[model samples]
Target: MHGPPDARSLNRRAAIKVGVALAGGIPRLGALSTDAPLQEPARLKARPGDPTLKAFAGRQQINTDGAQALAWVPESVKRDVASPLVLFLHGALRRPEIYLEQHISMADETGTIVLAPFSTIGTWDAIRGAFGRDIGVIDASLRWVFERWRIDPRRIVISGFSDGGSYGLSVGVANGDFFTRIVAWSPGFMIPVKTIGKPPVLISHGTEDQILPIDRTSRQIVPALRAAGYTVDYREFKGPHAIQKPILEEMIRELAGRR
Candidate 1:
């Protein structure tokens, strides 16, 4: 589990701040060059396979080529029945095991299957530079789950926290044709490599977040997305760089069309 903000994690956050500073207060979005692997054609090929059998119940490990990944299938989801899928990305210096159960619990309540995949390194590949190795890992995990369960193409979601959240906003938008919705918790900045579709976004940030200040982060991001013609639901709460469970629960329900 994520014990506390360690020195390495803090340094990573500091480096993120430096990057934002270097980019004139707002980190640049989209690919830096055409040659960059921002448009990974192969990684986008995974789609839900025909389910002959039901998905495995409860939490289980998924083979993502040595990269740790996990999936949670609720009992409410059955074979051949279209189920919602969430591809959850983790924060810096963290693993999927730390927060997979949280998503699992939520999945149980929402009847959604959650797939949490750890980055190839400390954080997402796009956060360090451009979308690279991690996209393959994610694609492999998605394929593993998709081959077992019939997923509803309309409810596919990409979500994350901190660095993961930032990457989610970027990648989710870039691959919007695949993901219908995006949930970002305390995201710092986005670096989208061209948006494919206009997927609705749900973003929540803590007012007192020191790691990624709400002022320069979500406050700015929400409007930018809105101005860009993407539907955005932004929520700001009184707290730190942490999630408020009730808000997430409500938003997830809304995303599921439960509310």
Candidate 2:
């Protein structure tokens, strides 16, 4: 009987399977422009023996609406002289604090400034026409952090988990020029791309996820992205909808290297 598969072995098998599926078929990776510069901001440069990792920690709330306040990770701690900023969007449940807590360790390891803006209302989608305002608030908040911290715009990375992951993809695809990298963990929303951007994407989904079917994302979404000619790094864990520690570690490493 076969023992449990190692992480590297599983990843290799997945990559080969994905590669073979695209071979002898209409080229889907042709839509992206690989000539774009990969240089990130100087702030993202890895520092040796930097104690800023332990010194960075703070929170603040922005009044997006008159009465409603949007909680976010403000630029309070001045650790690194220059550091890349990362905007994290929460899931549909709209709990920014929870999301931040979950990913805080990753941020420390990568030395990235994380900003998670909470929705005033429970959900980001207020109504049919309200998405614009909701997204605008998020954009404004990001700009606020950028201007306040003087962060490198090119090094900005956006990511989310589950419902947040879906929103992150939507936001990144819609405004791909603003971010250098996009990561979606168990993303639910998958949209078609008309004009592909240069930002590389890392999509992680669980094969055993019942909330969001793996086939839909791995088969349909991945194919659509490939057809659009986008460089997508897809990984599927043999678990459920939760974000595991090992996966988070890999994500941090990937984002750090991108910068």
Candidate 3:
């Protein structure tokens, strides 16, 4: 069986290499070297195909190892059609179900599917220090969804709010080819491992955000991303550390093909 390696085999090899590197070089202590940053451990392995679960509308709980994960499928969606999907991360000390409930309306309005996965602990592993257990949780949740639904690859997005927003930006940068779009709401900072495909970014920050000040966060991030040749759509509003309803709706409209 001497032939070109399949996508799954290549991805598996990459994962193994990442595992060895993390085990030998990158310590769980979360030390990032200036010359070499830690690569993101999680990778999207599943693709659109025949489903295992019956496609339906509304929320579905897909918890993993006691961690809460949820998906919101739009009403009247069909299994034969590929639907847009969003991988949403939650803020620090937040729950995925609450976050999904707050933003699931956007998915319903635009016929997009929303998947929100909880961090193993208080916050995302990367934000705490280095990428760890949460990576496996996210990847597992995604594989489950991919095995149960037809997702639109072109419309797959990574988005979040506050701490989740920061983590989403970081992960989206590392896996931009898979996540076609990146949306951050009142993000604080980014801990990017490596830049992958160039995906357009949409960031909305509150000018008066006290939790994660706008000046030190998105203000600095947007410029760096632009300098690195990323097309960023940055917006500033007069509010606190929260998602602006109108602004978010507009962004979702653009993503949902309504605009």
Candidate 4:
């Protein structure tokens, strides 16, 4: 809520107000006050639960749409090393907090900033998908994070499992300028939307997935993406509809630029 660590109190309040307004769906900056410069939140290196990611620790920040998120910031960044940002979306009926906890160490291990946003509803737009309000809250939250963190824009990633995975493909492709990579685990389908810069994509689906047949899912989607000239890495695992820990670890390492 507070402006960047050194900003004045007035700036902090003004920034919070501005953020609230933007989160409320006013996409136009002119609507808030074209003349005012919204100060960013101060860099809080660590919070209560995490001695690593201060304000970005375990707490949930609710957006105007009532959507919420949990984030993790790496403990340190090597000299000349630009930290990456990873936003992981959970499957349907899943909590972002769980994803945060599950991947907390991934941040330190990779010197990455991790964010997991929860859908305000039972699931992201239920059956009515296509990067709706959930995407808005995500974009706003990411903007807020950007104000405080010096994340590498070229390494920004949008990844998820199941339905979240499907949405990641749709949104990441649409917002290629912001997200350089998309990792979809057990994705169902992609919402054929206008795509931008050919961001690299990683699609992993279980061969035994009964919920969504692989032949009709990643098998087809990966080829289509490649046909569209997008770099793709497709992996087929023998299992049911689920994300394997080993695959998760591999993906994180890949994103971190580690072999």
Candidate 5:
């Protein structure tokens, strides 16, 4: 007689089932055409029942392997006014949905348009560049959002946590012309750039983050930005490698006020 399945075995089976279901529904964009420039969505139509007027409702096929999509919390609170856009990247665990949920309250309060893009791969690599078709996919997605929405280009902000945080620094600092503000939490050092366009950056690190040392950030990343003439706000928190709700709220408020 077969005994009951163990918890770990049951979980593995469930994970496999979920993966298979997702794979069947979404086509992989890997090994697809790289010659064509990614296209942006033509219009920004109001999505119904979007609490924040921002819905993560668009899908794009970057290549043949698979497509990545994002949900947006559009600036619905102040219908008459156009608000700044905030693009948030998720950590290596690849939980974009969770990230959006965590920040939904803040986004709604500030009338900020939140864009959280899903990485097809587990982690995003800004140093070596996005693998397979991710580069095209990401570029297309960003352009689509900017063009589709009546966004204030000068007020764009990019933020992330953990691995995503490192990406925020890499992308935000390199493309400073595109984004005005950046928030990086529990980030590792991104590949150094010879010159970075100046932008306001808030780097928050936890003292007990063993995964990515706080000292490395204080010693290397912060100094590099300062030396590059970028305005940096570095904060050290007394915690582990997790985002503190209070600090995150304050940062969001400060950024929203600037716009």
Candidate 6:
């Protein structure tokens, strides 16, 4: 049900087509409009009778009012402690559960909470163009998480892979003050509506990324990010267009310590 090679998949072929189409040029962004109201983020509450607080980690389909999201929360820390939260956006056609499992170690190793939400469609809304419903879902999810956990607002990070990576770059940069850090893996591009405070960014790409070739992605993204004056930490791997184990480990390591 996650990502394999479906017809609706945004595979390497899809990446190529999209990248080429966007080659024309990206539009400049200003601040987001104040209209188009979105449903307020839902709050999570623990039942008074509960002996232990809910410590759950799985696929949680949330119907926050009319909004829908797939979030994966790490098991609650013992003694009712707080943990850092990472909002991970999955690559095109990928599922949130798989992304959580891939980085499951963060739960115990760093006492970090992970939340991954699905896009309205197969790929993120910004991938095809500008921001859309997905952004609303993201906002709602963060509000939901904040209601339950004692998250350090200063340590929240927006990160993702591929298409999700690109969207993360766009949104994270636009709302830099909101997200202290932005981690992007093999991102295609960074297009934001408006600029915000400078948030340090971490990026990694494989040398042999045939899909969104390195030259066309991180190579461009890193410098542009730097040109924009963002503190950037970039890494080049000897793998493909995927987030290898070591890359994931490093991401978690830095995130866990960012707070």
Question: Model 1: how far is 225 from its true place, Å?
Answer: 1.1
lDDT of 2 by residue, 1-259 (tens): 1111221123445445434543443232233233434431101222122332222245556554332323333344354455666677765546677666666666666666677876556445521112444565575565545444545556777787765676576557656766788888776554322333657888887787655556754545566666666688888778866566676677666665554
> How does each model score on lDDT?
0.75, 0.56, 0.71, 0.62, 0.58, 0.67
> Candidate 1 on 11-96: residue-level lDDT in tens?
66575664565354454643322344655532366887686534578887877566568888898988867888888888888667
Give the per-residue Cα lDDT of candidate 3 at 75.
83
Q: Per-residue CA lDDT of candidate 3, range 117-230, in tens? A: 878886788776677887777777887777778877888888888778877887787777788899998776667466678899999988876566676678877877786778
Scored against the true structure, residue 187 in model 4 reaches a CA lDDT of 70
- Model 1 weakest 10-residue run by lDDT: 1-10
Estimate the TM-score of every prediction: 0.87, 0.68, 0.81, 0.71, 0.69, 0.80
Q: Across residues 147-255, which tens digit of lDDT does each residue of candidate 6 receive?
A: 5556666667888887878888878866765777889977777654466678899898888876677876688778767876789999998877677667677777777
lDDT of 6: 0.67
lDDT of 5 by residue, 97-152 (tens): 76666676777777666767766676675423533344445565565554445566
Best by TM-score: 1
lDDT of each residue in 169-238, candidate 4, tens digit only: 7767766656778899877666545555677888988887655567666776777678667899888888
Candidate 1: what lDDT?
A: 0.75
lDDT of 2: 0.56
Pairs that clash in candidate 1: 30-192
Error of 2 at 235 (Å): 0.6
**What is the full ranking by TM-score, best candidate first?**
1, 3, 6, 4, 5, 2
Q: Least lDDT summed over 10 consecutive residues: which range in candidate 4?
A: 40-49
The residue pairs found clashing in candidate 2 are 28-226, 29-229, 31-229, 32-229, 91-164
- Report RMSD (Å) for each prediction in the order shown: 3.5, 10.7, 12.2, 14.1, 11.7, 5.6
